[model samples]
Every structure is written in structure tokens, then in C-alpha cells.
Target: MSKRRFIAALIGVLVAPLLTVVMPAGTASAHGWITSPASRQEQCRAGTVSCGEIKYEPQSVEGPKGLRNCHGNVGRFAELNNDGKGWRVQNVSRTTTFRWNLTARHRTSTWEYYIGGARVASFNDGGAIPGSTVTHNVNLGRTGRQKLLAIWNIADTANAFYVCVDLNIS
Candidate 1:
């Protein structure tokens, strides 16, 4: 066979095997699922209040038996100011931001905080939960810690929510 023809045939043969390999649609190759909340009840639980601040950790359900990192739930983690101010605390008139450490299973899961039962802010932790113990920063007004909860909204599996933290404003 001519050199060009031989090269073309070789290419075709290699490409055919790859194209024929059945790739399950929607199959996640990444290990781990989002371990967030499943319902509003779990997300609405009070937060952990102490030292003029409220801290929380979302609930993570045991994922499907597989790679430790392969498959988890979706949830939210948050911290609120519980200084008896409500939504506004120190700083008078200012908007502050914090770099919070998070522990997530999915590579695209996110964490958000709510004020007065409204979605206020969110952060993506590069798909890694801050493990069992990680504190992420959040913006809060000069108000004592109020009713706030972190959430984890998983897409698949039994929708689950956990009030991993609660707080009482001082």
C-alpha cells in the first residue's frame, strides 16, 4: 500500500475503537456526589451561636458504596453573626467579604448564606467540602446571630437536608 494510504488506514482503525467504546450518558467519572440539603426543614434549622457569631455545617449523607471520593450528597455550610444585631452588626456602613474554607464532595457544589430566609450570597469551594472542620467567612451586618442555616441541595438520591449548626445571638 502507498505510504499515505497506509497511514490513513491506521488512523481509521484507531479512531474506530475509541468511537465504538460505549460511554454511559450522564455517567459521572468524578468520584463523589453533592452532600447538601434535601429539604427546607433541614436547611431551616437554627445555627450554632457563640461569641457573637453563629456557625453551621451542612449534613452529608453516606454516598453510594464506591471510591471514597466517588459519589456524595449536596449541602450548604454557613456562619452568621449572632451579636444580637440581626442582619447588621459592627462596621456601621460597610460590606465585608470572607475567604471561607469548605468541605464538598462534588467538584461543582457551592455554599451560600441567607438573611431573613432569603438567598443572599454563595461561594464555590472548587468542589471540596471543608472536611469535618473548616471555617469559611461570611458577610454579616451589625446584628446579633439570628435564625440561619447552611443547606445542601443534592440533585439525585433522596433529597436530604441537615441542620448541622445553630446559634443564639448574644
Candidate 2:
């Protein structure tokens, strides 16, 4: 083989693997979802709630923050926002712990929980990288059936993951 061709081939072999390793590390793969109290996506993942694409990727219901949709207004995950979709409400107390399972940790701005259009609780992460698991104790304050929308806002991105948890408060 020609010396130039051999040199080019050697360069390609060396650069390709390095690119693969560097690319994946730099690519943003932030993922997280509410697990305890069983968010809509969690229920779908657990086979307790029948859903669409979100059933396979509970940690991926991401969109811009300030939107109150469970599927983050994404068409593929719209099933999560369906109020009549027969999602099972877990029995909860006035105060319950909401747990987040982070598959790919990201720097977080804040974690917010809402019920009936009012934010009930929030935790500020202050742009710090979060742990594999995060928890927030929320006080629902209201009795009877309710739906809670939890949002995880990413510090570096203009996006947030949304999880809707149905609760039957005692």
C-alpha cells in the first residue's frame, strides 16, 4: 500500500475510537423521573398504567419548564396527561416523600411539586450536580383524590422533566 494511504488509514483508526469515546461523554443524556408515589411514567413502566412511548422511557418526559403537562406537551407521551386514563391513585398521607431516580445526573436548578395549580413544595439544588436519588417531602395539605405535578428543572438546559402522580390522600 502507498505510504500516504497507510498514514491516512492509521490516522482514521486512531481518531475514530477517540471520537466515539469523546462524543458520548459530551452528549447530554440527562434523565430522571419520580419513582415513589408512582408518577404516571413510573406507573407506565411498572405496567400499572397503560401508556404510549413513555412506558418504555419514564425518565425522558422532558420539555421546557413552566408547562404543566405530564408528557411535557410531547405528542408521543400525551397519554400521561390524560385525566380519564384510569391511572391508579396511591394512598398517601398529608405529607409524603417523593423520590426521584436519576439515570443520568445533571446539574439541577430546582425541584417543584404542585397540586391544584399551587406549588406545594420545592427544593433548590442551586446548579449543583444531583445524586443518583433525590427525595422531597411534600405536604399535600388537602384531602381526597388529587394529582400532583412534579418538575425537575435542569440548571444548564432550558428543559425540565415532568412527572404526574395521582394520589388518594387520607
RMSD of each: 14.7, 4.4
For 1-170, candidate 1 gives per-residue lDDT tens digits of 89999999999999988877875545322222122211122222232123111122223332332211101333222222222323322121123332222344433355555556655456665545445333445554435534444443333433323232223333
TM-score of each: 0.32, 0.84
For candidate 1, give the lDDT: 0.35
Clashes of 1: 56
**Per-residue alpha-carbon lDDT of model 2 for 73-166, expressed as tens digits?**
8788888988999998899999999999998998999999889999888899999998899988888889899999999999999999999999
- lDDT (0 to 1) per candidate: 0.35, 0.89
- Highest TM-score among the candidates is held by which one? 2
- As a whole number from 0 to 100, the lDDT of residue 41 in candidate 2 is 86
Q: How accurate is candidate 2 locally (lDDT)?
A: 0.89
